[model samples]
Target: MEILQVIILGLCLGFVYALMVSGLTLIFGVMRIVNLAHPILIISGAFVSYWLFILFGLDPILSVPAAALTVALLGVLLYKLIFEKNAAQQTYSEMTVLLTFGTAMVIDGLLAFLFHNTQRTASPAYATDAIFIGDIFIPLAQLYSGMVSLGIIVVLALFLKYSEFGIAIRATSQNRTSAELVGVNVKFVCLISFAIGCALAGSAGSLVSFVFSFFPSRHWEWIAILMSLVVLGGMGSLTGAVIGALVLSVVSSLVGAFYSPAWSTMVFFLALFLILIIRPRGLFGIRTD
Candidate 1:
């Protein structure tokens, strides 16, 4: 029963993990540029939800769209100022990594300065409520967050499959030169892809704000853990990221429940190492090169 509870909890958390990694992987697939600053954008989203609640008394869930849209606009600005101006010959160049990593640091520092380094959670009364099943209990916040995560994933999937912009994004990711030659604005697609990716991150953050306690610096921990999921699933595969999240979240939860809390975090990186050794490209990862 305890193990079952743990698995249930893990899957619940996995829903949000899947949502978070989806954007990261999508951005990598389309641009061939890993957004190392992605985690901070999620944190920025969380702060947006946090402040909206603290200042205006809005529910965190209700704040998600506003946070997502805000980050989407910021994503536009970020691409224009950073990536657009410095289009390198090599997409995955060392300079791209440094630029994004530095940008992550800047966002982190600025957020810390403005919001302080203290831990916070958007804990409304409903967040504490739980539904009981026999001997197991599920928190309302996790359940709601999971539902919202699923909704967002479905919306994205539909967009990618049916929408014009979505088709363009897929074409560009599959082959940039061919896409450009065939009337797709490759640069514009890149910009839109980055924006959508960041918007997803921010929406995930809104869910995360209610489900977990976090500080501005938590991105360090999040990025490391998420990297494992991203790698385990493959860099650009949406399905892979979701599966990796479920597997890793379950593993981490089981390790924490059966072994110790401290070791739970190690499981993430360890999974990354083991997966890389077994399959250098990841379970479903295709080489972009």
Candidate 2:
């Protein structure tokens, strides 16, 4: 029974985790740039939701779209002002790593200045409520957030599979030069893809607003978790990211149930290590060889 409860909780949490890393994966898939600032953007989205609730009594769920749009615009600005410059350079990959890391620090400082270092969470009416299924209890916040995350992922997947722009993005991901030669407008695709990624992160953050306490610096912890999920699932693979997140989340939950939360935190690294040893390209990553 305890194990069942833990698994249920973990699965719900995993959905949210999947949403959290989805945008980063998309960004990597489309642009091949590791947006280290992704974690900070998520926290920024959380703050947006938090303030919306505090200032206007808006529900976190209702705040999601606004948060997503706001962060997406920020993503556009980042791409236009910073990422676009050296995007064609030979050192683009290595440069983006440093650039994004710096961007993360700047955002962290800005958030700290605006919101300070204090932790905050949106407290909706259902924040602490839970549904009981026999001996198992499911937190309402987690369940709702998980459902929303899943819904978004489905919509995103469909869009990627069918939409014209989506096809362009996928083409760019597969081969930038070929996409350009086909008149896919690679620049526009990159910009829009980055924005979409940020929007997803923002949406995830809004869901996270009620489920977890957050501060600007909390992104440091989150980035590590997200990177592990991305690597475990195969960087840039949306399906892989979700699967990895679910696997890691469930394993972590089990570890916590058997031992302590602190120990559970180590599960990401351990799982990542084992996965990399077995599959160097990640579970979904394509092998060039």
Q: Provide backbone clash counts, one per model.
A: 0, 0
What TM-score does model 2 achieve against the real structure?
0.98
Tens digits of lDDT, candidate 2, 254-284: 9999889889989998988888899877999
Clashing pairs in 2: none
Name the regions of candidate 2 deviating beyond 4 angstroms.
none
Superposition error at 247 for model 1 (Å): 0.9
Off by over 4 Å in 1: none
lDDT of each: 0.89, 0.93
Residue-pair clashes, model 1 = 0
| Candidate 1: tens digits of C-alpha lDDT, residues 233-283 | 998888889899989998999999999989988998999999989997898
Alpha-carbon TM-score of each model against the true structure: 0.97, 0.98
